[model samples]
Target: MTGPHALKPFLLAFPGPLRDRLVAAVLSGEKTATTGLLLEYEAEKEELPEVGERSALIDSDGREVAVVEITEVQVLPLRDADLRLALAEGEGYRSVAEWRAGHENFWHGEEMREALGDPGFVVDGDTMLVVEWFRVVEVLREA
Candidate 1:
C-alpha cells in the first residue's frame, strides 16, 4: 500500500473548489448528516503534467467544504465492489447495499441526480475517476 507521505503530494496538489462541490453534493442529505457541506475538491488547473492544490471550506448551511484538492483526474484501479467496501468501512456501514441505500435515500434518489447533473466519469480499463468543482467556506474544529 502507498504511504500517506507518498500520497501527501498528490493530496496537496489537488484542486480545492472541485473537492468542495463533490463533498457538498455527496454529503448534503438527511441520512448522511455531514458536519459540513464542504468536503474536498480536486481538478486540473492547467495542461501541465500535475498542478493544483487542495482546500477546505464551509457552505451556507454552516458545513465544512473541501475545495480544489484533486490533481489527477484519472481513474484508480479499484472495482465497484472495492469502492463500496472501502466506503462502507470508512463510513462505518455494515454492507455495500446498506451504503448504496443510504446514498440513494440521502441524495434524494434519482430526482436529486437530475438537479446535480449527470455524474462525471473517467474510465481507464477497469478503473474509473470522477471530476467536479465548487467554492466553499472553511470550518474550524473544536479544540
Candidate 2:
C-alpha cells in the first residue's frame, strides 16, 4: 500500500476559470471531491485514479499548487449524482439543481466541444463519470 509520502506525483490540470475556482476550493479545504467524464478518460486513454493516489494539483499556468490524495473513487451515471456529493464539490452549490446546471453547461459548452473536437457531444442521464473524493495532503507554497 502506498501512502501520500510514498506515491509518485500525477498531474491534475485545472485549465480555466471554473476549474481554477474548484482548485482554490480544494486548496482551502472547502472542496473534497470532483467528477470527471468517463468518456474523457477513455478518449485520453488515461487510467482511472485509484484510492490512495496522490497528484500535483496544477493551475492554468502549469504550476503545481498542492498535492492531493484520493480517498475514494466511485463510478456512476451523471444522473445518479446526489446533493450530498454535489455539495462536496464546493463552489457554494447549495442545491443539486445548481450543481447539475453548472456542470451540464460546462460539459456541453462550446469550449469543451472545441477542445475535445466533438461538436455534437451531449451529457445525458446515462453519461458515466468517475467520482472522486480526495483531500489536500500538502499545499506547495512554492513550486
Candidate 3:
C-alpha cells in the first residue's frame, strides 16, 4: 500500500573505525566526491547478494574492515505512473526481516558499544589522543 510516506530505511553500516575514516575524509575534504568513494568501495566487493545486497567494508588500503549488509532496498521510482504501475503489479513488496536478522551474525554480534570500547589511537598534528575506551554512535548514511 503506497501512501504519502512509503519509504523504507537504507542502512550503510560500517565498522566503527572505517565509519570514522569516512567521516574524517568528508570533514577534511580529502574525498570531496563521496560518490567516488562509494564506487571504489563497491568495486572491491568479490560477490553481490542475490536479493537485497550487502557488502564487506574495506579500508583505504583495500583491506577488509567490516561487512555492510543492506537490509532493505526500497525503490521509489519518481514517475507517479511508474510507481503506480509497480505497486499495482506487486513488484515492490520484499521481506527485509531475514536480512535484518543477519546483522547479529556479522562481526560476532559485536554491538556498537563493544566496538567503541576497544582501544583507539587518534593523532592530531603533533598531538595524539589514545583512548582506552570510546563510545560513539554516529550515523554513516541514511537514504
Candidate 4:
C-alpha cells in the first residue's frame, strides 16, 4: 500500500463461467499463478505488477473479494512458459503443451478477442507474456 497506486484491481478474465471458475480457484487456494498478455498491459496503459505489490482480486460482480500479494513476476515469450508455471495455474493441465493449447483456446475466444480490441487477434509462440505468481493475503468475501 506504499506504492504510487495503493491498490489496483486484479481481474482474472472476462466475467462469466470462466471468471467465476477462476475466482473460485483463487478463493480456495487452488490457483497461485496467472498468465497475461503484455499487449493487455500496454492496451490499458497500466504498469506491470511487481513483486511485493498487492492488489484486490475483483469478482464478476465488481466486488473486492480478496487481497493478493504478488510474489513473483516474469515476462517472457509465451513459448518459454514451463511446466512449473503450467501447474501453478491450478488448471489441472498435465503438460506444458496442454497448457498452451488450453490458453490458446481462451485467448482466441470471442470475449478475450473483443477485450483486446482486435477481433482477429491471434497469439503465437513469440507473443510476449506476463506470468505472475501471487498469494492470498486476506479474504474479503466468504465465498
User: Which residue pairs in model 2 clash with each other?
Assistant: none
Q: What are the RMSD figures for all models against the true structure?
A: 11.7, 3.7, 20.8, 2.5
TM-scores across all candidates?
A: 0.33, 0.87, 0.22, 0.93
Model 2 worst lDDT window (10 residues): 5-14
State each model's CA lDDT, in order.
0.33, 0.80, 0.29, 0.91
Question: Any runs in candidate 4 off by more than 4 Å, and if so which?
Answer: 1-6
Candidates 1 and 2 compared: the better one by lDDT is 2
Whose lDDT is greatest here?
4
lDDT of 2 by residue, 17-103 (tens): 766777778888888888878988888888999999888777666667888999999999988999988899887889888988878
Q: Write model 4 residue lDDT over 29-82, tens digit each, in one string.
A: 889999999999999898999999989888888888899999999999999999
Candidate 2 global CA lDDT score: 0.80
Better of 2 and 4 by TM-score: 4
Task: Rank candidates, TM-score, best first.
Answer: 4, 2, 1, 3
Show how many residue pairs clash in every candidate, following the order shown.
34, 0, 0, 0
**CA shift of 91, model 2, Å:** 1.2
Candidate 3 similarity to native, TM-score: 0.22
Q: How far out, in Å, is residue 23 in model 1?
A: 9.0
